[model samples]
Target: MRRKDSHDGPARGQGGGTGGSGVTAVTGGGETGGVTAATLPVFLFPSELLFFSEQRRCHRRVLTLYNPYSFTLDYKMLCTSPSLYRVLEAEGSVRAKSCVDLVVRHLNVSPANCGRRDRFRLEVRGGGQRGGREVWAELRGGEEGGGEGEEEEERKRRKPGGHQQRGLQLPLVPTAVRPSVSQWLLCVLLALLCAAVLMLPLHTDSGSMVPRCLHVSTNQKLACAYTLGLLTMVFLR
Candidate 1:
């Protein structure tokens, strides 16, 4: 709507180049045609439709479709492998110059069937419905998310004060001095010691003892108590 001494040219790293036509470069590089805007539908989505997440049974993705026309537009989404995916709101009508939402749900793909890329088509028809426009989005596989309890269990390992730190690793000592053998022997000895300690009778000033327990001298009584204390400590460790 204005005149200038300019002409659009090969755009370098700078100003609106030199051209009669106002020039703007898209993110990935493209030129928009004013003539085509009236017939085109604007759609937004991920560059790669591949899903790597498994946190839910279905991956919900929202597709925003805008109608640039002066009249309402009717559109439907379809995919080559319809069985592998679902559209929560597959078809819808958008008011003139307004936008509507379409949800493209990515169903769970089998592990073996994953990582394969596919395309889904969006078909749109304008006012007179005499002609139409079709665009396909290509989706590639992305990193997957974990299932339930999987992420939580991993977080537990990273959190402080955990069962994760309770792992028991055997000593790398020589076979002759292997810790397992030593522990087994020690456990057996400790068991016997505890039984013996329990059977010892408490010494009384009158030299009386229960029939189930043998009477022990005062010195022996002290030794029995020491043994019991040591056994408790070992088991706790």
Candidate 2:
């Protein structure tokens, strides 16, 4: 059987660039003047091939094939995705070479092979927002996608919250300290101290009943106690 190999240069910045490892300068002109789309760098797989051979196992027909570039065991089956088989049938054996060739060129290297039955792991990487910072994503092989692809799809499905812009990160919890019972306790303790100081000065001078210090009036003593208590609370807080 034959294989029709193909790859779509993923949508620009889709999955954050997983096609090629080089920077591509996108230039354009507008009313303002000529402009560049900045340096867009990405990693990609070029030409590749998958070959399936028919054999008999336990008196039953079986097709055995493996893509060295595949990232999952589920797609390791020789005839996994039925749609791809149709493409192979359409292109025939000879044309499949072009498909494989494209992936190789995109990846910036000649492809490698470790026997026809060996599984493959293909990945593309590119620099992200900052210069020379690279991000990698494994390429999905066969007609079906793999684990990484499913995760990517899930990300696309999620919508950003109100504070988060389309491409921006969402803020977590806010910075303000939460209100709690300790603050209330501090206020209550300060009030009790003020009441005690206000009543202390009213009692007659006596060794056991009167305060031993300066005989300030009830209001003054209460005000002083309130001030000191407030200061202590502020410092502790």
lDDT of 2 at 22: 23
Candidate 2 residue 32 Cα shift, in angstroms, is 45
The estimated TM-scores of all candidates read 0.39, 0.19
User: 1-237 in candidate 1: lDDT tens per residue?
Assistant: 111111232112111122212112112112221112334534544334535544343355556665556766665554556666666445555566566555556665556655565455555676665232233333334334443346677788888888677566788885443348778688768768766755666656344446534666767757766777876666666
Candidate 2 lDDT for residue 111: 22
Off by over 4 Å in 1: 1-41, 129-237
Which numbered prediction scores highest in TM-score against the true structure?
1
After best superposition, candidate 2 residue 5: deviation in angstroms? Answer: 21
- Candidate-wise lDDT, in order: 0.50, 0.31
TM-score, cand. 2: 0.19
Count of backbone collisions in candidate 1:
9
Backbone collisions counted per model: 9, 22
